[model samples]
Target: MSVYTEVGRDQLIAFLADYAVGELVHYQGISDGIENTNYFVTTDKGEFVLTLFEHHDFGELAYFLDVMTFFFEHGIPSAHPAADRQGRYLKKLCGRPAALVMRLDGRGVANVASLAQCEAIGDILGQMHIAGQQFQSRRHSQRGPEWRQETAQRLLPMMEADQAALLKNELAFQKGYADLDLPWGVTHSDLFRDNALFDGEELRGIIDFYYACDEYLLYDLAVAVNDWCVDESGTLALRHYQALMSGYLQHRQLTDAEQANWNLVLRAAALRFWLSRLQDKLFPREGEITQIKNPDAFLKILQQHRHQPFSVDELQ
Candidate 1:
């Protein structure tokens, strides 16, 4: 989360008046993500995260908060929102929608995830997908198919020839499976390594539900696998892949259709991140970023998926 909006001590203290979080001791801006402003907030009462929405409005954020609540209620290890004295989770802060969530334990492993960490991520994701079956409300991703297509088109003009060709062919291939009926539910849509926290090999919690939406459950797993189970060079790590799948299967089993489209799902997941990172690179956002993600990483991942394609069975 980028610190787009800066909150002064007085401003934060005044805002905390609505809640019972006690007097603020200190707060520091968190610059790990791109879409939102996050600060590690501490008070006499407890530690929490303060998020100022950059792209989403008050109304649009309700779904994400509700999703957080749902996950919390379902015993999922996720960041849960702290309600104000008035029992409201969504509130206003410095002219933007904001909310405070109990900060989860542990640090992000990022690109150094081990085999056991991969299995933990997969197990938790499987459990989340299963619990999502009970979710009554559904919302399509803001970054869904239409947005991806439009983004790819916009980025094509700015891409190298090889990249452009790969983008076009992948989009065409992905379009064919758009209507395929696979196991679908609430998806964490962006469960990269940084989004999940770990205390050593033990998973503490999954944070950043901002990208959570209704989509193919398998796609969610693929997104996690892409980030958590890949080597530095973007190649699949066999031991990690098998470990992840093994953990996932402990919670839920895949359908025949999901198995049939497994490799394609992996490829689709690769393209989505590649296109998004490319878009971010070309149309640079004006902000202070802790680290801007590299598009070339996803490019390499996509190329690996395409050239050395493997089935779910192979990975398992």
Candidate 2:
């Protein structure tokens, strides 16, 4: 996360006046993400998070906010967007589209995640997927099939020979599975460790709904498993995998198609993140504290999933 837009005290005071959140006692820029500008805001009434969209416009972002709202209304742990005095959840701040959301009382898993934490994440994810099935909104992934292929083609020239070859091969391998008959719905496509909040042993909140989109439920699980159940070397940690899969399977059962295509979806998840990291590294935007993650880390992950045929049947 990076502070792309800087808001001054006077500017914030003026912005807060539009909302009936009491007097703003303090506010500070939050430097944790790469997509949007965020700040932790405290007022006499309550604590809230101020987010300014860097990439999404007001129209395009409404779907994501609605998705979060849907989950929160259904008693899920996702944060609720606060409405202004005029009952609008979105407004302009410092020339950027902005909104305020209720901040949860938990922080992300510090450093390595515990087995219980991994299982908890899987449980919440399964629940969210179940909840998402009832949500009527449909927003396709901005970084789905077309973007992945186009981005890989655009970045191949800047990559090492092996990297280029690997990307091409993976893209080709994944292209055929794009239209499988699968259980599809909204997915938290980017549920990395930093995105989930934990209080003690419980996952109290799930933030960063900007990447949530219409996708395969299984693909979403694979995305979560890829990050939550991997080691520093990008290999699967068997116990962590078992815990996560166990947590998810308790809520929903996987079909034979979903089970058969599990490894491919895992590889697809790895490839998507790898291409995105590579894109960020090569064409980064200017921000106060935008983090540029290592592309090679995901490259190793994709290679591991591709070369090693780790069967889902072996998961138990």
For candidate 1, write residues 1-316 as lDDT tens digits.
8887888889999989999889899899997977888999999999999999988988789999999999999999999999999999988998989999999899998567888998998899889988999998778877767877999989988888987888898888888656878989898899988898999999999999999888889889889888888887999989988888888899999999998998888888888888887777788677654446788998888889889888887777
> Which candidate gets the maximum lDDT versus the true structure?
2
Residue-level error in angstroms, candidate 2, position 2: 1.5
Question: Per-residue lDDT of 1-316 in model 2, one digit per residue for the tens?
Answer: 5688899899999999999899999988877767889999999999999999988899888998898899998888888999998999999998999999999989987566789999999899889988888999888888888889999889999988987887788888888767888899999899988899998789899998999899999989999888888898988899999999889988999999998888888888888888888898899988876777888888888888987868788877
Q: Give the total clashing residue pairs for model 1.
A: 1
Worst 10 residues of 2 by lDDT: 287-296
Candidate 1 clashing pairs, residues 3+ apart or interchain: 1-33
The deviation in Å at residue 103 for candidate 1 is 0.7
lDDT of model number 1? 0.87
